[model samples]
Structure formats: structure tokens, C-alpha cells
Target: MIEMKEVHLIAKLADLQEVDYHNTLVLHALIELLVEKGLLTHEELTAKAHALDSQLSFQLDLASKLSETIQNRHTQIKPIS
Candidate 1:
């Protein structure tokens, strides 16, 4: 396993709290291990991460639009037929 010392340092520099800093170290270490073990090639990991990011961004955009629609719905004044 790659030494997580550098990752921890990075988390600290990024101003993550203690738990988050340590969790970042752990996450990096696990990813490194996965890459080293061939379970996830670097390219595969990169692609997967990018895909997830894109999906998450899309979900957030959809959620924002839905929320706006719902918020606006309450303000609509329907005319009597």
C-alpha cells in the first residue's frame, strides 16, 4: 500500500476537519490499493469518476429544476372556468 502520509498532508492543507482529513487519507489509500491490485486500472478509475461526476451534475440540475417548478406551482392563480 502506498504510504498515506502524503494524502493526509494534502487533506490537512486543504483544510479538511480531522475526521474528513483522515477519511480522505483512507479513501486515497483504498483507491491506490485497488489500482495496484488491478481491480481498477488507472484509466478505468478515471473514466468511472468522470462518469459519476457527470451523472451527479445532471442529477443536481434536474433536482434544481424540479424544486423550482414545485416552488412556483404554489404561487399559480387558476382562473375559474
Candidate 2:
């Protein structure tokens, strides 16, 4: 049998999905208006998004490498008596 807590969680998930759908619709409408008004071009938006994604990926990779280096260094340290 489904518990009351499980029912509440399911309702919350549905609410989140509705909110996400609404936000997506708003974003699409804003993008369409911007393009329609000639304030921005599709190519420009695509290029900027791609650039941002590339930068984020590079930063994440650098952070992962730095974290691994820190862990390795910590493991290599010797304790003082």
C-alpha cells in the first residue's frame, strides 16, 4: 500500500514538473520575442551558449584534476612523531 508520505512526495514531484514546464514556455517566448524584434540573432545565441558550455567543461575538468592532485599529495604526506 502507498503511504501518505509517498503520496505527498508524488504530489511535490508533479508540482515541480508543472513549474519546469511553465519556465520553459516563458524562456521560449522570450527568445522568440528577442529574435522577432531583431535584438539578437539565432546564430549569436547559439555561439554564446556553446562558448559558455565549453568554458564550464574546461573549468570542471581542471577542478577535478586539482582535486585528485590534492588527494594524492595528502596520501603521500608522512606523520611527524
**Candidate with best lDDT:** 2
For candidate 2, lDDT tens digit of each residue in 6-80?
999999999999999999999999999999999999999999999999999999999999999999999999999
lDDT of 1 at 22: 93
RMSD of each: 11.2, 2.4
Name model 2 segments beyond 4 Å from true: 1-12
Model 2 earns a TM-score of 0.75
Give the TM-score of each candidate: 0.70, 0.75
Which digits, one per residue and each the tens of the lDDT, describe model 1 over residues 1-81?
A: 657998888878777577787999999999999988888888888999999999999999999999999889977967779
Best by TM-score: 2
Whole-model lDDT, model 1: 0.89
TM-score of 1: 0.70
